[model samples]
Each structure stands twice: as structure tokens, then as C-alpha cells.
Target: MRRMRTWCERFLRKRSSRAWFLTESNRIACVKRMGLEAAGAMSRSPSAKRHTSSVSLKILVDMDGVLCDFEAYLLEQFRSKFPDEPFIPVSERNTFYAHEQYGSIKVELKRNITDIMSSPGFFASLRPISNAVTCMHWMRDIPDVSVWICTSPINKYRNCVSEKYQWVEKHLGFEWTKRVIMCKDKTLIKGDYLIDDRPMIHGEEQFKPNFGKHVVFTQPYNCNVTTEWRLSLWPERKDKLLDFIMFLREGLAFRD
Candidate 1:
């Protein structure tokens, strides 16, 4: 270290070296050119690249819109209970929380919603979205990609969490039961990708994404969020997801 400092002091006498050293980036490059030993010492510092070949890319999937059609299931139950209620197609809805559309009978609707969410079988009975099962099965066997079903349960409803586990084990099988993470704040969880329906989870200004690409799943409520990766159907969405994972893997395998 003393030798390097002396060498730097000698170079300070040169006008070109003095100007070059003023810029931190240029000084670092000059040190590399001087000798590999100094460069190796710098590389070992805190700024060193710690990433390794053994590190795997993580793919975190949402349970509701991405896989299980929770919105569809809830709507179906709503329609069944109120046969005489004026029909409003799901497309006409602008947001997922559009309970105001239920009109004067919204009180009953709210009660039903709470009851269903708190019920034991509500989450378990949800049918898997088309192509979701096949896509998940394929993802589980993919190399270098760690897959997890990251879901948020209605924390107020105590049964919501256990029901989600029951649903995962029954549909995705027991193997996936181990990968379920129930948390409302997705930002705290780090990953390479987050495939979900809502983009600005709570609010962009308040709850910003901590990292990675967010592929918004197509839902009538989230139709207003315009983006390049909005996938409407299952089959097409599955292909896109796999292609994105491959793209990430290729990038990781390559070096300058």
C-alpha cells in the first residue's frame, strides 16, 4: 500500500496524471493498467463483485390473478347468491374493489365477501386458471430457476392463510406447499420477477418495487395500467413467462 501511495505521489508531478486522478473512474482504470496486483487488491475490497455461477435466478408468482382465479371465483359466488341482481359483466368493471357497483345491496355483498374470505374452503375451492397448472409444472423442473408461489392473504381473516396452503397442496401438489410465502408487502421480498395483476400494489409513491421486472397479469381491474408485458390469456402468457426466464438465464450465463 505504501509503495502504491509513493508511486501515486510521483505521478502527481505529471500534469496529465494529476488531471486523470481527479476523476475517480479514470484513476481506477490507470491503477489496473499499472499492474494486476494493485487491481487484485482493489477487487478484493467492498466494491468487489460477489455474484457467483452457483447463484440461481428466482421467479416469484402471485397466487390470485396469476394462477388461481380468485376474482372469478368470488364473482361466481356473488352471482349465485343474488340471482335477481341486475347483471354487470366483469368487463364493465374498472377495478377489482368495485363493490360500489352492487348498489343499495352492498352491505349484504360486503358481509358475504368477508364471510367467504374467512371461510376454510373459499381459497381451496378456487379453480386453477387455464394453462396455469401446466406452466407451473414446467417451471418446477426448469434449470437454474427457483420458483415460489408468493401470495398475500387477507390478514384480517384468520382462515385466509391456511386456506391458501390447502389450495396450493391440493392443486399444485404437496411439493409446492413448501414455497408459499404470505406477506402483504411484496417489496420486502427480493426476486428476479414478480408476475401479478396489480402493478403499483398500494401506491407507486408509497410502496415502490424493491427490485426486478414486474409482469402485470391481465385483469379487468388492472386494464388501465398500460405496459408492454400485459398478458391477457393463459397459453400466450405461459410462453411469454418461459421466454422471459430464458432471457434472464442467458444474461446470467454470459460475461464481458
Candidate 2:
């Protein structure tokens, strides 16, 4: 463990100087390799194994709006593709689905919206929301918290599915790609908290009960949702979010 720590420190120092020269994949590979090596060394130590066993909190974060600027990117793509078409601005959007907002408008407009969404590279090209990546890393580093990306792909899965994985790998690193859960029915998944922008998450005929608390990740559309826990700003309100998670963790322990 000592040797591994020493090597990691030295490696970090070396990488810090030339980080700009390294490609995204290469940088991710280097960091992942070091993490695995350190984890392997720690696993051999009795104290580390005990510490690992204590981790219990599971945080399931939604990808599209929570992590990436999905709506913003979609709007941009829609505008660029169909220049003259009437479209609802992001601020004016009142529904979770963008296409729903265009229902009263031209049928061609709605089809154009869907086309933009189903297009190849649309999901992969979305920019990460400001401070979202940083906040995710912070959450993952929390001793007891286990952060996982729980996202639903569009019904047009051909492009949406592969691009979602690529997006995670490109932005959050390859290690996080393994943590991606591409399931339509999120209520079936178990976790301590689920941060999502959708006002209603339903499965099949009715809305199923989620095992975890649904912490609304605020967006223009979901502003109407009345939830006790909501994350409107990243990093800025992250401390309060942590407090909420910890409070729940303690409450669960007390119940036990």
C-alpha cells in the first residue's frame, strides 16, 4: 500500500506538468490504471477491506439533463437543422418532453424535433452542464456514497444507446461507462437518491414506487414540481445536497 501511494503521488506530479499533451482517452486510461493499482493494493490490506464494507449509500444520478446539457443541445440542433421552423425556446418549455411542447404547432415541427433527437451523434455531442462533472466526482469521492448514472435511452435506441455510452466515456471517463444503467423503468432500480429532471417517471400502465427518494434536478420544464429535495444549481448547492443524503443515511441507520 505504501509503495502504491508513493508511486501514485509521483505519477500525479509527472502527469500534472504534461496533462495538456495527453489525449482524453490516454489521460483517462492513466488515471484508471493508477486507481485500479491502488485499489488492488488496498484490497490486500485488512483495514481497507473493512472500510470498503462500510460503504452503503447509493446515489443514482440521471444523465441527460442532470449531467449533460441535453435540452440545450437539442434546441441548438433543431434550430440549425430547420432554420425557419417555429420552435419553443428552452425557457418557454413547460413539459419534460420537448416534442410535447410542440404538439399544438405544425406536425412537421414535431417530426423535425424527433428527427434531431434520433440523429446519430446528437447524444454524444452534448456539452456537460457547468460544474456537473466536478460535482459528480465530488459525490463519488464521498466515503459512503456510491454514485451511478441511471439514464433512460430514447425509444429510437440505435443511435441513442451507443452515443450515451460514448458520451459518458468522453466526459466522465471510461470507468464511469460501466456504471451507466440504460433502463426505461427507473422506479425498479434501487438507490438512496435519484436526481432527475423528469416531473413524472412511470413504468408500464401506472407510476411505480421508487425505492429511493426522487430529488428533482431543476430545469425550466420541471419548475412546477413540488419536491422537498431539489438541486437547482450544481456545486453551489452541493453542500446542502450532501447534507440531505447524509441525513437520510443517518435516518436509515436509526431506523435499523
Candidate 3:
């Protein structure tokens, strides 16, 4: 329990620092908005306060899709598990349901939707998407931008929680372990931006963007989601993200 408490403390300290930077960015935007100077001070208006409180700018980066090529890993696992079965090409993987695409195509491996996720080394072994490491470093270096890995945990796989931590530490470096947040309920988290492939859906209708700026991380499954910030493959993604952050930082200086 003492270890748990220590971990929480570190996370809060790190996250709060990031949030502070984001808050300062918003403050800059606020000052620009209130160019109406009265007695050398911006008017103490309710609108200003509301806008200040509205945006809590912290960057929430997802693990499975945004950073790791998780689907490709799964395909590899399936092929090994059922060597006799017809191999499902990576292009055929268009959705979250692995079984629907691969199950009984010819020889019928019949793996379940959430199979092998609990198996040893599954989370720790996923390959990093190209340029994802470079992108993360660039993101971390950004002024006052607190970048955090907010990933959903598979409830059935207890090892997944720890393995994910290990994976980040292994691939992304030790510093990232401090920034990783293992969570299933992303909506419960508060942030200015979320880069994820998860679709925003509430039953039949679209889930409203209560989650600040929703930057959809493009994956085969989540390509259905329409957004201006749908990032594609690497190198391009790395450049776009850098441009995106720079645009926000510079735009706030002038945006009224």
C-alpha cells in the first residue's frame, strides 16, 4: 500500500506540472482575448474567468493504437497459435473484432475477440509504430505541454496493467513510466486533448466532445471517425503533431 501511495504522489506531481504549463498557455490566450485594458489591468469580467476555467490543457496520448502497432502484434500471435489456419493479411484487419475477420476463413482457428491479451508478454511485446518514439520526445520537449499516456487496461488480464508499464519503460524509455496512466475509463479523465483511435459513441449516437479537443489517432478500426486531426502513418504523423502543437502555441498569441 505504501508503494501505491508513493506512485500516486509522483503521478500527481508530474501531471500537475504539465497542467500548470497548459493553464499558462490558456492564460496567454485569455490575455489576448481581453486586449481591453482598463487601468493597466484587463477588466475583471465573468467571461474571462469562465474561459480560463474551461480549458485544462493536458495532452492525453493513447498506447495501443497511437504509439504501438497492437493489431499487427495480435495477428502475429494468431498465426503462431494456429499455424494450420490461413494467415489473415494485415490489410484485412479493418475492425476491432479479430475473430470476425480471421475466424474460420479456411481452417478455423476460432480465437475469441479478446484472446492472448492476458497471455504473458503480450502488452510488453507490441512493436512501436514508426516515428512514435521521435514524436513522443518532441511532444515532451514542447513548452509547458504535459504529455501523458492514458491507456485502457484489459480487466481480465491483471498482467496487462504491469506489462504496459514495463513496455513503456522498455521502448519509450524510463521517463515515460512516470507519465503512463493505466485506465479503462478515459471519459473520467480531464484533459485539453486526447489522441486516441477509440470511437466516441454513446449507444447509437455520437459521444459529445466534453473531452476538450478530440484528436482522433487513425487506425483501421477508427478510420470511420471524422475529424480534422485524423493522423495517418508515421513521419507524416510526427510532422503533423509538431505542426499542430506549434499552431496552437502561436495561434493563441493572436486569437481573439
Candidate 4:
């Protein structure tokens, strides 16, 4: 029975890979979520030892929009600093540029960075977005699912990652087993999936060829939207963040 089960799994994996032109691996989420108990029981039930390989889903999640709401925090900071400044929607950028209305724009400055560092409450008040916890839970439930947080480290801002990690610990209530990397090139580091907002950094195919799918968390400033896979952070948005993640899980598979 043990050998037969192994053979069956190998056969199924091969079939799935060939069907989708994907590489063969035991990263199937369903297998991990559903079959672990049975696999364990068969091995210890005085029956033949089951040779079932535990499937682990590997995910590389982006820190800012996917895991936390950094953009909204920035926006709030901007508004607080310059309440009188006229609101210029991110979509209106082209018009603002053409009209040379750059003066009305509120940019996050060095002082704002300092403010973020100095104020504990400012950082503490930053709550994760609506589906952030759910996303984390999904990754946790998977036996083999490991989430490596990838974020672009602001070159001048060395302490950015430190604050972010502290926030993550406060929110997650535990240290992450998978390490977090503060890197300029997220795609260069290996992972099955990348959840990020910046297309210019992680969007390039060179950095993410092996990724099953790249997930972009939506924002007003990130106005240039792409249809391949994206989710808006807005409460009333059409695609919930979870919806996009589920789509990736069901539709995509990593390949060599």
C-alpha cells in the first residue's frame, strides 16, 4: 500500500505538471490542507507505512500593501502635514503634470521619515489592511507554505526594515519562521510567489521567472493597473485581496 500510494502521487504530480507545462513538486495546497491527518494515520495505524510526501505551498509575500497598509499610512501623514493642500488624485497625475501643478502635490519627505521614526504611536496605530490577517492565516495553515517577506529597503532609510519587523511581530504575535529580506531586487531572490505593489521593481520578468504569479496590491498612487493579477485595498473594490490569492492558487503553478 505504501509503495502504491507513492506511485499514485507521483503519477498525479506528473500528470498535473504535463497538463500545465509546470514543474513537478509537492507544493499542492490542497494535499497539505486535506491529506496530512490521513497520511499520518496510515503511517501509524499498524497498517503499512504510507509513503505520502507532505505538500507545502511556498509563498513570497510583499510587505507593504499585501501584508500591511503602508500607503494609507503615508497618505494620512501627508494629509496631516498639509491639510490645506488641494487633493490631487493619483489618477489626475497626468493632468497635474501637463498643467505643471506639481506645487499642489504632497510628497513624503525626509522630515516625514523622521516623524515616522520618532513617533511610536504613529507606527503603532497602523493596522493591517482588511484581508491582511486572512492572508497570513492561509499561508500559516499550509504545512509546507513558507512566507518570505520581500520589501524594497529605502537606501537612505536603514531603520525602515527594523520598524516594519517590529510591527509585523506586534501584529503576528510571533516571530516569523521564514526570514524577511530587505532587498532592492526582490525578484533576484527565489520564491514561488511575490506580493508587491511596485511593478517597476518586481514586475520585470527577469527577476520572477520561476514565480507562479506576481500579486500587486492596489493603491491610488499605483494608478497604472495591470490585469494579469492585482487587488485593490479599497473596502468596496471589485476584487478582494483573498480573491486574487485564491485565483493564483487555483490557476498557477511554478515551473523550471
lDDT of each: 0.63, 0.71, 0.62, 0.51
Q: Any residue pairs clashing in model 4, and if so which?
A: 56-144
Ordered list by TM-score, greatest first: 2, 1, 3, 4
For candidate 4, the clash count comes to: 1
- lDDT of candidate 1 at residue 214, scale 0 to 100: 69
Best by lDDT: 2
- Those runs of model 3 whose alpha carbons end farther than 4 Å from true positions after fitting are 1-56, 99-113, 201-210, 236-240, 248-256
lDDT of 1 by residue, 1-256 (tens): 4555444455444423112123344344434434554334333431121222233778788988789987778778767866765545667766655455554345566666566556667788899998888788777766667888888887565777888898888888998899987787787777876778775665232355653666677878777876544456454344444534443442321100
Lowest summed lDDT across 10 adjacent residues in model 2 is found at: 247-256
List all candidate RMSDs to the true structure.
Answer: 13.2, 13.0, 13.0, 10.0
Q: Tens digits of per-residue lDDT for model 4 on 1-256?
A: 5443554355345433223223333334323434555445333421122122244446777766567766457556656875775544444433212113333343444355445534545544566888676567655654445677777645445456567677667877556624677667665667666666665454455644554556565655455655445545422222232323333444434221
What's the distance in Å from true for residue 56, model 4?
A: 3.9
Error of 3 at 130 (Å): 0.3
Model 1's TM-score against the true structure: 0.67
Q: Give lDDT for model 2.
A: 0.71
Please, what are the lDDT tens digits per residue for candidate 3 over residues 178-211? 9987765676666767778776622221364444
Report the backbone clash tally of model 1.
0
Q: Candidate 2 regions off by >4 Å?
A: 1-55, 204-208, 236-241, 248-256
**lDDT score, candidate 1, position 232:** 62
Clashes of each: 0, 0, 0, 1
